[model samples]
Target: MKSQNIRLCFNNTVKALFISALLLFNTNLFAEDLEVTGNITQLGNDWLVVQGYTFYVDQNTELRGPNGSIVQFSFYQLNDLVQVKGNNRGDGTYLATRVKLEDVPNNSNEIELTGYVSAKGTNSFDINGTTFLVDANTIFRGRRGNPFSFDMIQVGMLLEVKALLQTNGDFLATRVKAEDDNHQHGNEVEVTGLIESKSTNSIIIGQWEFFVNSQTVILDRNNLLIGFSQLNVGDRVEVKAFKQLDNTFLAVRIKLEDNPQSQIEIKARIENIIGNDITV
Candidate 1:
């Protein structure tokens, strides 16, 4: 748990949302669940062999499937759903304790996050059966946004979390800060000049400033598409990016977006002028 000093939002990060929906739809089609186990006998380049089974895992995956499967543990594979109790083998696979191919809890591993008091999400965010209000003062640590939205966060996304992990297992982020283009994740940076243009993949963050995904720092690329695609030129914004080794994101999801030249629509027509009310 870290201090709840920093916070970020969807409009401010470059997180790639986990496409759980895609996985769910595909997995649900499996007829009969299956499970198997064997000692992790062979470890090879980009692949693992347990008993006589073979599987692959991402280079960055913490442990193939969890349950403390660390370096060189025997492993198991599940057909439709998989659950394991074991150790990691450092080779992107896990040794097993209790291997089963049963339906994973629909909402067990899924966690609902809430920042501190100022950044509650009760107005928009909810979990299993709980809700909380959110504001700039709240925090959402760990990137857990939605993948499909392009504005949501996801796993492996870095974030400035602002709450302690309660003994009961609840994420209480007081503030959330998405990492930036340079993998830096704090404070505000000055991106000056007029936005040259705006498009889906490319956005003119500032005059002569053409920001593309790979060029800028970000947490991940999940929900960033939403934030990036909806950007408006001339809309001056201040943000911070978080970076690790090769990633970045906006610090405070977009603390301010000042677009003086854009039209403000009050209803059916685009108004040339608008008052303090964005929509009334």
Candidate 2:
């Protein structure tokens, strides 16, 4: 009977150790730093909502406006497209360490764009070779006065954008409306979508094919320079390209998106097969 009790105690101790290790593994995931980019949807007394995540700002949090100018927290207004670097409190709230506003054009110099919706980012979209920044104030409409949101927008759909042009050559969209142009021609365009297939010299994004050459530049999600060989199928990418005389897209630059939330790990499965000149 004494030996039975000792065995029970040993089993309970083993279970306790396993539970503690599991808790530590989960804690590490929540302790990692986080960065989010989106439009401010709500402004509370000491907190704000970006996309859907709520973040609180303390006195030590750094704030900056356009042109990298230091600014007070009150300077940020609703619908402002901003990036927040913060730490997760592990309870669905974030403690912001820094907030930086994106460069958006003032209410002047309206420009119009008509092309495919190549890609959609946190609070921005790319159309017709230009990146258009959006905020809550930016209107989104469908054909014939229908309502739409950024989540409804997809790759390969035709869209018309009316925006203000910034001095730095980017655009700040005031309105984005959809268009039905099944027969419209592809012009100089920017596209963002998943890479359906890829080769050493080219890739297919959505319904468009982009060809790369020596002059084509490749960048990672952080805008760091990389090589074409680093790309793979199923990667989400954005491409700036020009339509050539032969109707083929000549890629000028390609940017790969490295979203931390999308990070995943997998194990490779080895297949037993023999090639023409080798055996496995």
Candidate 3:
């Protein structure tokens, strides 16, 4: 009779242990959340596919674009690169919690660009792969601070542009000024490139070197003054400098591109698997 009671007790203990294991598994399953960053390859009425993962969006999902403005699901378009924060439902379906649009290079409003004009149109032009639209309010100037007409703009000329970025990635020129690239004695020079490296007093953009002294002026996208400490590698910038006799560019003013904030997501990659452990 004692052995019989022991058997019954063992059975009950086994049942309790099994239930606890099952509960733990269920908790771990629902805990899998994921984030993704990639271009939208497919779109649907209620679902979208990015980087081979299908994510479902419902009323609870929050969507935003430039300036952190709330947007609808319909605002997303094909080929738009985006960052998504979501949860994995453990059944191959992802539930989106938030979606943020990433800005395309040279596609934002705050670019103070200097580039050679590639094409000239009646009311617009192409520079550095970006289109600049002009109107009556557009101000034009020459190398000597002289007023010029729109007709003076020609292809193959270097120009400096201060423009506002449009929602659709077009640039509306507030000011268009020509650069006298042929003037060998001209001390003024402008360039736009990603910062390769920097120090407290200098920075390297592409292959060209630039120096920033105490008198140098630096501004962010909002036109607010900033310091060299605020700059970082891989930041795109436009620099207006004076060409020194030694050929090094002395930065008189600098402008950094202020990209909009986007929700960032990344996929987890498993590097190795061992008996019951995984490396990611």
- In order, the Cα lDDT scores of the candidates are 0.33, 0.64, 0.64
Q: How do the residues 170-279 of candidate 1 rate in per-residue lDDT, one tens digit apiece?
A: 53444454443233112113342234476655445422233344223222223322345445556554433322223222222332344443222111111222442221
> Of the candidates shown, which would achieve the greatest lDDT relative to the real structure?
3
Displacement of the residue 178 alpha carbon in candidate 1, Å: 13
Best by TM-score: 2
Model 2: residue 78 alpha-carbon error in angstroms: 38
lDDT of 2 at 270: 21
Q: TM per model?
A: 0.28, 0.32, 0.29
Clashes in candidate 1: how many?
77
lDDT of 2 by residue, 1-280 (tens): 4455322122322222111111112122221134556678999878898746678899988899989999989999898888776654424466787888978733324555555555578888775346789878889998887888877776555677777766776668888888764321223355566687987789986456789875566777765567899998888787766566576777766778665222222111122223421110
lDDT (tens digit, per residue) of candidate 3 on 197-239: 9987888864567898654657777655677899888887777
**Any runs in candidate 2 off by more than 4 Å, and if so which?**
1-108, 166-170, 186-199, 203-243, 246-280
